[model samples]
Target chain A: DAGITQSPRYKITETGRQVTLMCHQTWSHSYMFWYRQDLGHGLRLIYYSAAADITDKGEVPDGYVVSRSKTENFPLTLESATRSQTSVYFCASSENRLQETQYFGPGTRLLVL
Target chain B: LAKTTQPISMDSYEGQEVNITCSHNNIATNDYITWYQQFPSQGPRFIIQGYKTKVTNEVASLFIPADRKSSTLSLPRVSLSDTAVYYCLVAPPAGYGGSQGNLIFGKGTKLSVKP
Candidate 1:
């Protein structure tokens, strides 16, 4: 079903550069989220969108931005990539905002040098 | 969201059943317990979820106590491929709080299955 897909599965960028990870879902879910996973730290939410044009900050939103111009796509932008930003980024979508199952994308591995 | 605590790591044999337990002593009434499995390079995948009692699916089973303070994810007949980090999360039902749909994840239990 191509449920959820992430682009640029791998990226190598330098510090001070900008990078955007794209996420697209075919389910047309109402909610989408961005998360980054690092070693020894489980997973932290970066940003989330309840609906198109409706976005909110998550636990670790600093230096990151998100936009949901369309329901099917939610992209995460790193304004200034840093070495700490080198982690596996994941995008997920849920049908609802409450107690719904979240389906995840393959993930984007970004390396900040 | 209730804070969850789980083992740092576990080991099991291929034919054994692995039960990973999680404790959320401060869980609220409306909170639901969910589990997710993540491989080395993939995103976490939802495994099973339950509010109370027991919920069974094709892949796994979730057992919750009456108080909802703890949960256990039981996997049957483990294999090498089942080696992954299993996360346990507790969050209130949507719209009840500010971080609705925001799943707060803690360091999960790393399961290692050997032949």
Candidate 2:
């Protein structure tokens, strides 16, 4: 499909397990971002990639890892998932800078038991 | 990055105009104010953006005063579907290689539109 999409719309896993959420965009934008939204709160950026192979940490990045091996994909990995890591993860893409409007994916809901 | 503060929630009836204001006292000269609206179980969608004066788009209007210390997002004749969380953010001048904390999203104002 066109635009941005996320895999495993819903997931369930045990603590200390490894989990990966995939995000893909057809626009081939230069900027890709990962944000986690907890209940009753706004989105907090976890990681952002300026381009392929260039990623940086955002507001909450301690337990999450992100890589952009290709321009179309930016995957977030939870090496050792914890109960606090359970949240709705959203992937966003923008053509240019921070002032530009971002296009967001449907989001992946992961639960760590 | 500038810190933004807004109300936690608001209530309005259908066909009434609703405005949600955000304050950013420490906003920089190169920053721009933007707003986003998110429905339940979905990602946020951009509503409008402005630097000064007023900016109007099909979805909403953004009003920024001369001081640029605050901004208001105005929605016209809001309906039940417009009941959602509205986020106000101050975007910094730089991108890419700039400081990663240029954008901060606090708990946004949840506007509930009743019938």
Candidate 3:
């Protein structure tokens, strides 16, 4: 497809395990972001990359790691998964312009036991 | 960063006009108002954006006053398919290097359009 996609649409893991959610976009947008949607938190940003190799922490970046080696791919890794990390993860991309629109992926549902 | 406040939920009948307003009393000079719509289990989609006055697009219209304290998203003749959670966002000003705007989403107003 032409839009963004996240791999392993559903995942299950145990505590202390390492898991990664993959995000890839065809638009080659310079800005890629990862957000976790929980019951009351709405969408809390985990990490965002302005361009390849430049990533910044967002509101809830604890225990989550992100890297953007390529403009089209930004993978989010949980070093040590916990029960609190279970949420619907969404990946979004946008062009490098102020007030630009962000296109979101279908989201990855992760369940940590 | 500007904080936003909106109603928790609303209901309307099909073929009726719907307007959801957001209050941003502390909006900055360069802040822009934007609205997004999200269906259940789906990502939010951009509907409209405006800096001042009124800006209309195919899906919706955004009205902003001169003081920039608030904005309203108008959906004309909404249908059953228009039932979704509408988010009103206040974007950070430009000149900070085009990064991903940290969208502080308030509890969005869930509009249920009855058929």
TM-scores of the candidates are: 0.93, 0.96, 0.93
**Candidate 3 pairs with clashing backbones:** none
| Better model by DockQ: candidate 1 vs candidate 2 | 2
Tens digits of per-residue lDDT, candidate 2, B1-115, equal 6888989999999999999999999898988888999998899988888899999989889999999989999999999999999998787754666657667775799999999
TM-score of 1: 0.93
CA deviation > 4 Å runs, candidate 2: none
lDDT of each: 0.88, 0.89, 0.85
Kindly report which residue stretches of model 1 are placed more than 4 angstroms away from their true locations once superposed: B100-102
Model 2 complex DockQ against the native: 0.69
* lDDT winner, 2 or 3: 2
Q: Name the better of 2 and 3 by DockQ.
A: 2
Candidate 3 per-residue lDDT, tens place, B1-115, comes to 5778999899999999999999999887777788889898898888998999999988888889889999999999999999999888776643334434355565689899998
- State the DockQ, from 0 to 1, for candidate 3: 0.50
Clashing pairs in 1: none
**Highest lDDT model number:** 2
